[model samples]
Target: MRAFFKAFHYAAKGIVHSLRSERNMKFHTIALIFVTIAGLLTGLSITEWMIILILFGGMLSLEMLNTAIERVVDLVTTDHHPLAGQAKDVGSGAVLVFAIISAVIGLIIFLPKWF
Candidate 1:
């Protein structure tokens, strides 16, 4: 039980660190705040709400994973290397792909109601 709780604590710590240190994380968090507000104002249906929540989780998780990958790559190689650059770029690209998809999905869900 203690170990499980400790794991949660570490997770929370990592989230805080990411929010504090990562610019992209901060951007995503701000986007999440706006989405939450819009979701409330739009009076999202249960299905829409579930989809939005999943997007939120998926976006944030990918961003964090990207951050982790960049950090690991940095730690592994202080000097420039093609493989390290590729690793970081790929991680960033993954986050970008998810962000684009999530934005499209958000528009699909919210645009009709807004207009």
Candidate 2:
């Protein structure tokens, strides 16, 4: 039980560290806040809310993973290397792909209602 609580503490600490150090994380968080408010205002359906939540979670998770990959690549190679660059680029690409998909989902969910 004690270890389980400590695990949550460590997870929160990592999230805080990432949010503080990663500009993209901050942007994603702000976007999430706005989206949540929009959802509330629009009275999103249960299914829509679930989809939004999943999209938000997917983007945030991918962003975190990208940050971790970049950090690991940096740590592994202080000097420039093609493979390290590729690793970071691929991680960022994954995040970009998810962000684009999330945006499309958001449009599908909110655009018709607003317009």
Candidate 3:
């Protein structure tokens, strides 16, 4: 239990640090704000709003993961390294996957309404 608490504390600190130093974290925060506002104003039913919320969260979660991978890679390898490059690439691929999934969800939600 103590170990779990310590790990949780460590992760919380890392998240706070990332929010401070990462441009992508700022972008994600701004995006989250906009999405929350839109969801509030759009008069969505509970189910629809839940879907939007999930999609919004999934992107942010993936971004955090990508940030974690990059930070860890940089920590381990200060200079250029092939394995470091692959680690970053995999992290980027995770972001791309989430972004594409979110885009599809957005289209599904907004396209019919717009048309």
Candidate 4:
């Protein structure tokens, strides 16, 4: 039980570290806050809320993974390398894709109601 609790502590620490060090993570968190506010104001249905939650989770998780990949690539190679660059680019691209998808879903859910 203590080990399990320690695992959660370590996970929280990692989240804090990423939020502090990663600009993209900060942006995602800010977007999450805005989305939550919008959802509350719009009086989102249960299904819409669930979809938003899933997309939010997906975007944030991908961003964290992207950060991890970039960090590991940097750690392994201090000097410039084509493969390392590619790895980082792919990770960033993944986060972009997820962010775009999340934005589109948000529009789909919120636009009609607002306009």
lDDT of 1 by residue, 1-115 (tens): 9999999999999999999999989999999999999999999999999999999999999999999999999999899999999999999999999999999999999999999
User: Model-by-model lDDT, in order?
Assistant: 0.96, 0.93, 0.80, 0.93
The better candidate by TM-score, 1 or 3, is 1
- Least accurate stretch of 10 residues (summed lDDT) in model 2? 55-64
Steric clash pairs (candidate 1) = none
TM-score of each: 0.97, 0.95, 0.80, 0.96
Off by over 4 Å in 4: none
Candidates in descending TM-score order: 1, 4, 2, 3
lDDT of 2: 0.93
The residue pairs that clash in candidate 4, if any, are: none
Q: Which stretches of candidate 3 lie over 4 Å from their true place?
A: 1-8
Task: TM-score for candidate 2, please give it.
Answer: 0.95
Predicted candidate 4 versus true structure: per-residue lDDT over 5-93, tens digit per residue: 99999989989998998898899999999999999999999999999999988988899899889989989989999999999999999
Ranking by lDDT: 1, 2, 4, 3
What's the residue-level lDDT of 86 in candidate 3? 94
Best by lDDT: 1
State the lDDT of candidate 2 residue by residue for 25-57, as single tens digits.
999999999999999999999999999999988
What's the CA error at residue 83 for candidate 1, in Å?
A: 0.5
| Better structure of 2 and 4 per TM-score | 4
